[model samples]
Target: MALPDRYTGDDFYCDVAIPSAAQLDVVHDDELVLAYHHTRPFWATHLVVVPKRHIDSFTSVTECDEADVRQLFAVVQRLAREVTEREGAAAVLTNLGRYQDSKHLHVHVHSGPQRDHT
Candidate 1:
């Protein structure tokens, strides 16, 4: 049988509480959101955009969550633009169910060809 896409149920993003400014390859950060390099990247250039406060997933969002939703998208927008300008291309991705390994809300901003990552 094939392995599952997301192995752990752990809230990987929330577990870190954000690494030190030095340890975190942070692309962008604010009170509501964070954009940082993937700890284990599958693309040549991969960044993870997350809400500082947990939101679960896109499907978990609610009317009360409007501000957080906007903030997360704003961060995604800035990072995608910055990466695309530098790399000439970018893609943004998110997943649900088994596709979302971490169980926390996040967006991926990436560019360049895929790479084998640990």
Candidate 2:
């Protein structure tokens, strides 16, 4: 199902713009709007990227937001490249519906050791 035109505004739950002090240095001040690293990373590196604006979800995104989405992905790609150079691989992802926690649209970038094949 699709979301409503007007965001519920409750989507803005996070106030800790940047998760850590080190993150401040790692992420570009101007480029970074908000971020958070996974406590238990599925990969070696897992970080969340969010725009300052409160966007509901990917499906809620409109044609007017194309540039914003492009810019957001550019940042994600840059981070992925950095991780790849440091760890040999990176993965980007996003969730919807029940999978999402805050209801705000965000992307996740993960990198690290490969899972062993049983």
Name the weakest run of 10 consecutive residues (lDDT summed) in model 1. 1-10
Overall lDDT per candidate, in order of appearance: 0.83, 0.64
TM-score of every prediction relative to native: 0.86, 0.67
Clashing pairs for model 1 are none
Q: Taking the tens digit of each residue's C-alpha lDDT, what string does model 1 give over 1-118?
A: 2223454646777766344434677888888888889877889999999887888898999998888789999889988999999999999999999898888899999999999754
| Best-matching candidate per TM-score | 1
The C-alpha stretches of model 2 lying farther than 4 A from their native spots are 1-26, 31-42, 113-118
Model 1, global lDDT? 0.83
* Model 2, global lDDT: 0.64
RMSD in angstroms between candidate 1 and the native structure over all alpha carbons: 5.6
Q: Judge candidate 1 at residue 94 and give its lDDT.
A: 96
Give the per-residue lDDT of model 2 (tens digit) for 31-72.
434555643356657877776566788879988777667777
In every candidate, how many clashes are there? 0, 0
For model 1, what is the error of residue 45's alpha carbon versus the real structure, in angstroms, after optimal superposition? 0.8
